[model samples]
Target: MPRMLPPGVGRRLRKGERIVLETHYHKTGRPEKDEGAEVALYFAKEPVEKMLHVHMLANVFLRIPPGSREHKVTASYTVPLDVTAYDVMPHMHLLGRRIAVTATFPDGRVQDLVRIEDWDFAWQETYQFKEPLRLPKGTKLRLEAVYDNSA
Candidate 1:
């Protein structure tokens, strides 16, 4: 997975620091070739203006019944500080059908962040805002995911 960092903010690795990487692999019955992977890091030559933050919204207690066609799960987070949102990413397994994210301001204004009417596990990606979304403090971020568990 590739992520975009906020301006003027970067991370440093201490000497003798070790990083661990993990991946989830789905098994197929056919023989496959495994190749080595590579990682690339980018740095800005100039000073950055703002720092980036990552918020992971997930529902871990899912209980979709067998043969059920539309199972929904929702989660929300409140913004404690004013920040500009640059992108959003929705994640789900093979049973996911749709997903949406929205923001509700303290003043009662609501904004749609992202809505995927059709969810595909094979083509998940991050959606970037055309312009950064300015969210004030006390804004509530909501995420809803729909799944199909039919046999």
Candidate 2:
């Protein structure tokens, strides 16, 4: 006979749950430019544990055409998580403006994990949740970040 499994081992994320986030910039878009931008993540509002070195990730630079209203980029990764309070943030160069983390469920229900309207690459920090979030096995976490590459 097969061994019995633990309870709640494969449940989906429920309402009022919290999550932690770890982010890193693939690379510095402008290595020669000293006046560009820098990004990093922090835990517990402190710049120490779980910090990701930005240069380890890929980076790209672009010059948007005038009168252009479209620029899109996507990065995907799986975060190993347990039931705990957490926050999400995206680290980017000067172009970063907004960051959105969404949790999609198998039942089609979507949850806004976290959002930062004004993204400051200098003050990059992952705002932790006041409460721990419980995520079920079927939970699908996604991140969407918007940037303003124009200087």
Model 2, runs deviating above 4 Å = 1-69, 77-85
Residue range 1-151, candidate 2, lDDT tens digits? 1222233222233478865554444445666434544444222332333322211112245344554334555544333443332445456666667777777665778877777777777756655565646656566677666766455
lDDT of 1 by residue, 1-151 (tens): 5665766765565689987776545556688656656676687676766656678877778788899999889999999999888888888889999999999999999998989898878646788898878999999999999999996
Candidate 2, position 93, lDDT: 68
The C-alpha RMSD in Å for every predicted model, in order, reads 2.9, 14.1
Score each candidate by Cα lDDT. 0.83, 0.52
83: Cα error in model 1, Å: 1.4
lDDT of 2 at 112: 77
Worst 10 residues of 1 by lDDT: 20-29
The reply for model 1, stretches above 4 Å from the true place, is 1-6, 22-32, 47-49
